[model samples]
Target: MTDWRSDLELITDAARQAGAVAMQHFRQSPEVWWKNEGRSPVSAADYAANAVLETVLRSARPEYGWLSEETEDTSCRLERETLFVIDPIDGTRAFIAGLDTWCVSVAVVHLGKPVAGVLVAPSLDEEFSASEAGEATRNGVPIRVSRHIAGDHLRLAVAEDLLNRLDPLFVRDVERIKHVPSLAYRLAMIADGRIDGTLVKRNAHDWDLAAADLILERAGGSLVDLAGERLVYNRAKVSHDELCAATNADLPRLLRHLGLGLQG
Candidate 1:
């Protein structure tokens, strides 16, 4: 098997290049089109960035299967032992609206688990990366999740409706952060300890979570379902249901408040 560190290096470089491509269209009003029956938007920048990623990554690792948000899905990836999962530009709506929270997310999944991942947000001048065997880093510096124990005011990035679902008394001590349009960057915030945790709505896909999931894990955090199951990538069904991400120490408390059983 190939070294995960090397794979991390590959995807980091690809994400940087892809991010650069996306930046060219940032705030320039690149053409946009809707997909998922107009529920989602895809911009010319997305296709351009996807092209760059496909060219660089596939050329370098021809044998690895490919699964990208901008590319048509194929069953071929499920048959491979490893594959590249990508979101050329995560947070397309934010990107179109001239927000800097967007990023290029890429991950290498081996045997259904992420071994290497990278997220490059050119507008924010940030690059987050990790390998299965190494610590997570942002701009070359190691990062860790926030250590929040009982009695500390929890800082969270969650949708309002989801927040409302939690008992009012349970959330009374919580500090809700403004919504971050980019899910990948939102998870990165948790990984780097910018916030305590977040509740992810259902229907998130592999391209959105795979890369950030690895980064969060290496940074002493986890992204898991209510049942406390860590996600598995490169599956035939790429979409995920409601999930939560937080530091290992705080995950159980957050889950308990959500009325989910303790982390498994």
Candidate 2:
């Protein structure tokens, strides 16, 4: 088997190609379907992109396993040493609504952690990637988390309802940005210093966060559960808790604000 870097090269290209495939159906009114009792939506653009990704990635690394939002899961992948975690078009609603916040998210995991990841947003002309040993990059340029913002001036990206969950003292100190449909892109924004951080609602799956989590980690930040525990992937239980991503300097304050990580 080749090194993880080789897999990074292959998956990054595959993700970009997959983005191209999705863009073709972006605003063409592709078919749509509701899942999880209509609480979630999926579109033909997502499946089209997944097909492109699976063909290219599986062909290049036949020994690896596969898991995707658009494809049925197989217990067989749980037995493999490595697997691909993918969300073909992460923001189906945005894509269907002709918005441009969606992207193709792909990550390779080994031993419960991501070895490499790639996120491609063709419409936005942005591509972000990283490996366990490489710096995070956007469009091939290294990226980093934003500096600490003074109190009362923080720009956070989170659902408005979550704000009410925070301590009123902290809530008054930060400004919330508009909510983004693509959860992956929301995290990516932190990697590029576009936003300070955000709170993730519970029930996010591995495919929704694996790629961008690594990108944010490499760029000097972290995505951790309310307990302030780092996220792990490829587990039998694929869903995550309500998590938050932030730079190291600001994580403690955010965690305290949310009434988490306050005890020893």
Candidate 3:
């Protein structure tokens, strides 16, 4: 098997370059284009960042298939043993609004699992990464999930609608953090101990979760669906429903508290 640490190094550099491309257009109000009938937005910076990332990542591994938010999708990637799964600018809405929450997200996925991943948020000057060979790290320092979350005040970062759906008693205990625009960054926050957890809405694509999933995993945490299944990468259908990331002891309770698996 190929060493995925080398893949991590390559994607880390590529992610930084992509983040730099996005940063060049940040706060400049780059042209916005709508997808999903204006419900989803893309900007010039997104395309520019995608271009830089594609040039670097694809050039380095031509045989490996590619899946990216900005690129045209082909079923070809499903045939490759390994592939690059990426989101050039994960929080395009935040990027457009000049928020520092956006990130250049990339992951090396092998056989429907992420082996190496990199996330670079240039605006916030943060870089997070992980490989199958090692622990998750931020700027070279190992990071682990903090157990303090289960204490008196549980810091939660989630949508209000989702928060409102939780039990009133549970809500009283949570110290809700303001909205984080990037789902990738939100999970990283949990991994690096910025927040305890977040409620992921449905329809999140693989690119949004793969990198952060590995990071959270190595950080002594997990990002799992309502039924407690681990998130997978590079599936034929790339979207996912609600998931939660927290330390192992906290996850099942969270799933129960949120009423996520009650339907079954």
Candidate 4:
């Protein structure tokens, strides 16, 4: 059997290499286009990175199944026990706009759960990774979720819609809210202790949140749906809705505020 650790190392390396390819194209003025009714943007950089990532990963593990945002999906993955789930470039809007918040997100899913994950944000000089049996780390240092209490003093991470829809109680207590275009990076921020928590009502795709979920969970954090349910992966439809991610601080209150109960 192939060593999962070594396989993960290869995946991590591939992700970084792909990130470099993206940065190179990102330096130049690349064509950016819209997809799915302008809900998401795709750039030349995205395809460039996807090509590199797919080539490297497939060569490294020829037997493993493949799933990626920029690649065509196939039913062959259903028969494979292990698969690679990836977003060649998350936050394409940020990338196309010459912003530095995008990243290459990759996850190793075994039996429908992520066993390893890596999120490389080259521009931010940050790489967050986690293994099921190992520690979660940013760069080389260990990281974890914050245990801070949420109140009038706590900061939050959210999209603009949620900010507008939140109850006055939540709005009043949240000391600050930072908008991050990439959901994966936002969850990674929670894992790296950069933010308190993030809430979203939209169903996030498995590829969008898988890597960050493992990173955060291993860092003593949590990624739950509005029902306070753990995020699941390898679904037929790669999208998810109504998810929240945070360090275990004040989670109960946040769920209550959202009128949700803990899920099994």
Maximum-TM-score candidate: 1
TM-score of 1: 0.96
Model 3 lDDT tens row, 161-248: 7777778788888889998889999999999987888778889999999999999999988899888899877778999987777776
RMSD of each: 2.3, 2.3, 1.7, 2.9
User: In model 4, how large is the Cα lDDT of residue 106?
Assistant: 94
Listed in order, each prediction's TM-score against the native is 0.96, 0.95, 0.95, 0.92
lDDT of 1 by residue, 1-264 (tens): 567888888888888998988888899999999999999999999999999999999999999999999999999998899999999999999999998899999999999999999999999999999998899999999999997676888998877767777777877988999999899999999999999899888899999999999999999999999889999888889999889999998899888876432222
lDDT of 4 by residue, 171-261 (tens): 7777556678888898888887777787865656888888888989999888887778886677677787777777776676676665522
Q: What's the lDDT for residue 52 in model 3?
A: 93
Which regions of candidate 3 deviate over 4 angstroms?
A: 260-264
lDDT for model 2, please.
Answer: 0.89
Q: Where in model 4 is the C-alpha error above 4 Å?
A: 1-3, 149-152, 260-264
lDDT of each: 0.92, 0.89, 0.88, 0.82
Q: Pick the candidate with the highest lDDT.
A: 1
User: Model 2 — which ten-residue stretch has the worst lDDT?
Assistant: 255-264
lDDT-superior candidate, 1 or 2? 1
By summed lDDT, the worst window of 10 consecutive residues in model 4 runs over 255-264
Q: In angstroms, what RMSD does candidate 3 have relative to the true structure? A: 1.7
